[model samples]
Target chain A: MVQPEKARSKIRIYMDILQAVQDDGMAKPTRVLQKANLSHERLTRYLGELVQKNLVKENQDEPGVRYYTMTEQGIRFLQELRKAESFVSGFGFEF
Target chain B: MPFPFLYLDTSFYFLSGIVAFLVSFYAFRYTRLIENSALRFLSIGFTVLGVGLLAEAFIDTLSFFIPSTSSYLLLHRLIIREAAATYSFLQVLAYFVILMGYLLSRRGPASAASSNGSMNRPPTIGFLASATSVVLASRLGELGVLIALAREIIIISSALSMAFLVAIIYLDSTGYLKHRNKQAILVLVGFVLILASQAISFSLGIVAARALGFSEILDFIGTAVQFAAFLSLLLFLIWRGKIGSTGKSAQ
Candidate 1:
């Protein structure tokens, strides 16, 4: 479970959405909205960006219910982000 | 007055340089992953430092290989002196930029993580060019003597910068303890060892060990300690990567 952060940057928000999707395994729109704390419009816009960036993929199993899944690049990006955060945080930064 | 344990000292620096360059590679990769200017600066700083250490090692090796003729000796001296000055200057600059990155991270995380807008050319390049010019200029006429004198001062200042880096990392480690971060503890220990190494190097002043056995001993100890510091960081990174793959914290 990812802890909800306050006033995240655009990048941070992207990370949050990715983490939420990863946590959910096959993230439904409502679950991601609740986890990312973004309105439908905002979530839609960011999800498009994430899909375009190749960090996230939008898939539908049956019909209308869209599930967001993290791509390989997305997972790698998250891992790198964690390492970078820890690297600098070792120097007292809340990265 | 040939140096004692010269090969050992150079080997340690070479190993340390290899480690620094490895870390720099990963840091630079991370900058591409994230939108953090601090990460970019940190990457650049470590790259400069890694290259500087390697340069020093190369210069030391060159001294041994250069033909001992009078003209060769003069050329050798000029090359080593200029290289040493540049190495010292880079040491200071690298540590200073790293310090600035940490400071910026603390003050305004947002600003520090912001994209490099309008920063067409990094300030580091200008610093290197200017510092190189000043060091090269000191190689002229009567000022050459002054450069010889100033070389010791530069080395001392470089050691002090290392000390300053240790202090900053040490302070940062206290916060790490509060967060119960094992990785940070490893980094703290590494810096402490590096700090001790720099202090020994500063006090020894053994560019040419003139039968001073104690200075040689101190130099050996410093080299050994610095190697350990680099090893610690390397191990931490490796261990952290393993844990990260498992989605767990080492703490």
Candidate 2:
């Protein structure tokens, strides 16, 4: 069973991926794989979910060969995540 | 007024000494997270040796400033003996700790061919054994025997270790090795440099002990080379980002 905490952590991972892409600007799947240390299997599923949510878009013809970019919604999501992280850490609940 | 050669040497030693202390401090502070007990012990021993060498440098500087005082000379002798003894003991301890780590890192090779492979053995043991032999030879005080035996061992061990280090670095730089594995390579390179420098300086010390006019300059140069090597190793550790955060996450 996927625990609630594990699901939440995945959300954070998604944000981190987006942040890394934003920081590096146009990273290939291979680069992301190395940087994030995520296996291909796990990355494919999570990336697919993000595409479904419209938080990220896929290149039409290239499919899995596409690079990930954060949409406006994804950017907003990351900002909120950061705010929450700051608040929790300020309360001595360090991550 | 004499260009403060002594002051310059002492300052460099002090700076390197502080750097070593900081490296050890970081190691100890993050010890809970480090999975490798041998690396932890080696780090602690390196720190102790750094402190001892730093104290020895300070004593040498004092001897120069108070060169004519009988009491000062006595104090200098005492401190030098103490520091050298501590440094030697810590160095040997570090060698054993690193050897243990190398052994542990090679547990259970997959194939029989790879089981007794050269890579599985402690690469730095040769260098350490050479160093110990040189020190023992120095104690014997026989010039021909010391030079012949020590030079052969030190030169052979250093050349082999240097080649191994270069190969590892090349593999890592080309991305043929994984990130964590690259870290292990860096650690090995750091230790190899330390051992190599010590071997060179010990060899020089043997020659300087015999030479009459060049004794002071030789001693200063030899110590400076060692201090520089140690400092470089510490800096490499920092650059590799090995400080803070433990190996628990690594496993």
Candidate 3:
């Protein structure tokens, strides 16, 4: 029997949001929702986590409008993720 | 050094230690981010291997300063020979630890992923200390025969270790790991080259110091081949870092 695909890991989800913000240079919640392919609620929750970890910073450009920008720590985390990926891939395993 | 083997061996041990230390440093840093048990084990194993090489290098260095006085010369030679055994013991242990780490990775992904704890340190020190003592206390007679037997055993063990690594890596490529790409090829080539060097040494029966020049030449070639293997791994790690910085595929 085929097994269901395992849920994406937390680090992976972290990478997704970071990448979204990085790609946009500064991402809106809606833009990140689309880029990271996460539900609005899930994106909001993860963004909260990223902010808590100081990986991403949020700025309210105006009333009811917010943008998410990756902090230096967030950028470094993403780089670390990439390195882990490359190293694991060298052994033919998914990180 | 008076003996060519001592000179070549000193250089080999120092270089090997440096290479292993560098690899261990990278491994330890990566483990901090990944938090994989297997990665931590790898870091620890390489660290132990590096320390073993450094210890051997130190002993070889000390051997050079031994006085040629008739009274204590025999004792000095005995100590040097014992140190060689100690070095071999460490080599065997290091490879075994690294092999276990690789095996651990294969047990299941979650096994490595879930264990975010750091490597335990006390057991490592205790194990090394106890093993070294046992090797040191082991009895020996007739230095020439002992050296030959030690070399033979080391060559055999090294060959076996390389074989195990090759098999493990091959399985890694074809199994769930699916690493059958350029990087896998590079790793495989590196291991194979090292295996070949061990095989060459084994065939040469390099234990008896009869043709010291020829034996040193063979050993030099083996050391060079092993260095190349370490170089390939180093190149791969650097390339990986470059890929990481460029924001390419997370894979």
What residue pairs are clashing in model 2?
A: B33-B246
What DockQ does candidate 1 have relative to the true complex?
Answer: 0.37
Cα lDDT tens digits for candidate 1, B1-251? 24557788789879888887877776677666666676666677777778877877887787778764765655555555555556666666677766666666554557876645232233356346545555566665544454454456456655766766775675567658655777777767777776777666666554532434575576578678978988887876776677657755334
lDDT of 2 by residue, B78-119 (tens): 333333433444454444443433343223112211222122
lDDT tens digits, residue span B3-105, model 3: 5566776787788778778767877787677666666666776777677678778977888888747765555555554455455555555656666667766
- Candidate 1's C-alpha runs over 4 A off are A1-6, A37-41, A60-64, B1-4, B66-86, B115-151, B174-179, B206-211, B249-251
Candidate 2: stretches off by over 4 Å: A1-95, B1-4, B61-65, B69-82, B108-189, B241-251
lDDT, candidate 1, at A92: 54
Q: What is every candidate's alpha-carbon RMSD to the true fold?
A: 4.9, 13.2, 4.2
- What is the lDDT, from 0 to 100, of the residue B197 in candidate 1? 70
Model 1 Cα lDDT, one tens digit per residue, A6-94: 35667767877988998998999899999999999999999999999999999998899899999999988766666665665554555
In candidate 2 chain B, what residue range of length 10 has the lowest lDDT sum? B242-251
Global local distance difference test of model 3: 0.67
Interface RMSD, Å, model 2: 15.2
